[model samples]
Target: MMALQATLQHHPLLRATLRSGWRERWSFSGDMLPALRWREGETGGLLPQAEEIDLRREAGLKVYVVQDRSTVDVTFQFHHACCDGAGIDRFTDDLMVHYAGLREFGKSYKFVPTVDPNRLAVRGAYGLSFFRTLKRLPGQLVGLMGAAQFWGRQPIPLLAHQARDRCTKSTKAYPALTSFLLDPSQTLALRKAANHRNVTVHELLVCEFFCALWDWQKLYGQYSERHWTRMMIPINLRDASYRSLPALNYVSSIFLDRRGDQGGDRDQLLKGIRAEMEVIKRFQLRYTFLFVLNILNGMPWALKRSVQQDTCKTSVIFSSAGKTTRRCPLPRRDGFLHVADLVLRDIDGLAPLRPYNCVTMFTLEYANRLKLNLHYDAEFVSEKQSDVLMDLFVAGLNQVADTAGTQL
Candidate 1:
C-alpha cells in the first residue's frame, strides 16, 4: 500500500542520482522514507510520513527537491530526518553557492557532512553534578520513572479516506481559494504588524496560525470540538562540533498543545502562544537536549512509538516568513523572490509509522495576501473541509492584525 505509493511518488530524478553513485547521509533530522498507500477509499494516495519533501540518495549528499511541477501549483513533502525550516534554509544557502558554480562551469563541490546522533551524549545531559545535587531523583514515579517536562511526540496515524482534501491548481483560479506565499513586500508588512504588538516575527506568525485555526474551526462549526489541535514547531540545533556532520533533520519541535481542551479567547490565545515562543526560544538549546535524552532511553516498541508521537504532536506546522532585520533587501531588489517552501511532513518512504488525519497548512506566496496549502488525509476530511480550515486561519490572521493595530 504505502510502499507502492512511495514508488509512484518515486522521484525519477532521485533514483537517477542514486544510480550515479550517491551515498546517503544520516543524522538526527527526521528523514523522509514512507510507504505510500490509498487511504480506505481514496483515488490519490498518501505517504507514511509528513508531506514536505522527496529526498533521495545518489552520492554523499542527499538531495531535497520540490515534487510539484511549478511554483504556482505547489505541493511538496519532506523527510523528517532532515533539518527543519531554519536548518534547511542554512543548508540551501551554502548549497546554492556550490550549485551555482557547478551549473555555470561543469564543476561541483563534495558535501562534507557532520554530526551523528549515534555519537552524541544524551541531549541536555544534566551533568552528574546536577543529579547529585538533587535531594531525590525527580524522574522516578509510579512505575513510570523520571519523565522530562517536554512532551515530545510525533504522531503518524493512517487517516480514513473520507478525511482528506484533494487540491490541485485549476489553470483558471478557483473561487473560495485561500492564497499562500512568501512575498517580500507582504512579509515586511507582517513584520511591521508584529512590531506594533511588541512581538517578534515568529511570535506574530504563531499567533496568526492559531487565529487561522480558530477561524477555520469556526467556519466549519468546529470551534466547539472537545479536542484541541496540537502544533509542532521544529528548532534547529547547531554547534561548532556539529560542523563535520552532513546536515539532516537536526531539529527538535516544541509542542504547543492544550492538556485539557482548554481553548483561549482570540486575544488570550495570541498572547499565550507569543509567551510560549518567547520562553522556548530563550531556552531552545535545553529543549533540544531534553529531546535527545528520550531517544536514548532505549524503551520497547510500544513506548518508542508513544514517545515519538508525543514529541512530534507539538511541532507539525506551516506558515509565512517576514524579515526582522529591517535592513533585509526586498525580493525585487534581486529579481528572484526569496520564496519560502514551507513543509510539514516526511515524504520519502511508505512506512506505516505515519500519523492519521495529519493536517499540514501552508500559506502560498503571492503578490498580495498569501494562499494556504492544507495537505491532509483524504479519508478523515474533504477538500471543502480543508478549505474551511484555511478560512479559519484567514479570519484569525485578519482579526488579530486588526486588533493588534488597535492596541498599538
Candidate 2:
C-alpha cells in the first residue's frame, strides 16, 4: 500500500529497523541498542486479521499492514525496550506525517529525527540525585508496604484460586484482547462530563474501572466492605529537554488506592483521585520511581529480577495516553487519511522476559475519537468474565456521563 511504503521509507526508526532489525534486547548495561525485523503477510483480506501478527518472534518489534475490505490496517507490536507509549506515539506521528506528505505532495520530504542521546534521563539533570533518592527510600518503602497490605486484603481468596485454576487449565498467556471505538460524539460527551465533574478523563476512567471491578466482585459474591484495590497508572516523565525528543520508556507509575466503600460516590472518588494526582505531580513522586528504576539498571540481573518481583503488587495496569492533536501531513481536520479511523491496540504477550499479570486497560483520544483496549490474562480473567467486566466498565462510563450537568 502507498501508506505502508511511505511510512516504512520516511520514519527514521522504522526505516532504520527495516534496514537493521528490531531485536534490541533489554539490558541494564548500554551494550545492546534497539533493532527491528520486518515480516510481510496476507490476511485473506478480512477484518481483525491484524491479530494474526505473531508476537512470539524474537524480533521484539513487528509491523504488519493488513489488507481489509476497504482500507489497510497497519498494526505495530514493539517490546517495551523499544519505547513506552509516549515514545511509540512520537514514532507513529512521524509515520503518519510521512504518509501524508507522500499522499498529498507525491514526493519524499526531509524527515526530522527526534532521537537524542543526551535525553537519556538516567544520567541527565532531569533525573533526581541518587543521594536524595536514597534519603526518600524509607518513606517510599513505607508507602509501598501500606499499598501492598491494602491490595492483599482486596482480591478474594476463593475468586483468585478459581481464576488461577481456570488459567492453569488454559495454556494461553493472554486472553482474547478486545477493542472498542468511541465515536466523536460519545468522546465529546465524556469529555464534557469529565470537565463538568472537574476531573481529568484519566481519573474518570480509572474510577469507572474500579466501579466495574467492584460490581464484578459483588455480583460474584466476592466483594468485601473492608477490602480495597490498587491499580497502577503509568505516568509520563518527558521533561523540557526530552519532551521533543523521540525516546524510549521514559515512564513511571503510581498505584491508585481505591477503598472498597468509595465506589458508591463516583464524584467524590473522582475529586479525591484528582487531588492525589495533583499532589503526586506537584511533589514529583514519579521521578522517585524512575530513580529507583535507574538504580535497578545498574544492579545484578538476579537482584533486579528479585526487586521487580517483590514490587509487582498492583491488580492491573491502567494507562490513559490522554489526547493527541497531531494530524497527518495532508490537509485533514480531525483524522488520519481523511476518512479512515485511527485505532491503537497493544499486542499482548510480546515480552516473555518480564512476565507479569495482564489485566491491562489502555485508552487514548485521537481526532476526538476515544478508543479503549483491554488485554487480560486468560489465566486470571476468564473470557466470559472479561466480557462482563468490559460491559460494567462501559456502563460505569455512562453513569458518570449522566452527571455531566451536575457540578463537582
Judging by lDDT against the true structure, name the best candidate.
2
> Residue by residue across 98-152, what tens digits does model 2's lDDT show?
5555655565555454454434435244555668657656656544554455435
CA deviation > 4 Å runs, candidate 1: 1-78, 107-179, 239-245, 259-264, 282-296, 305-332, 335-354, 362-372, 402-408
Q: What TM-scores do the predictions have?
A: 0.55, 0.72
Worst 10 residues of 2 by lDDT: 345-354
Off by over 4 Å in 2: 1-59, 103-108, 114-170, 173-175, 294-312, 325-330, 334-358, 405-408
Per-candidate RMSD, Å: 10.8, 6.5
Number of colliding residue pairs in model 2: 7
Query: lDDT per residue, candidate 1, 198-266, as tens digits?
Result: 777666666666555554556545554444455655444545555433324455445565421344554
Evaluate residue 357 in candidate 2 and report its C-alpha lDDT on the 0 to 100 scale: 41
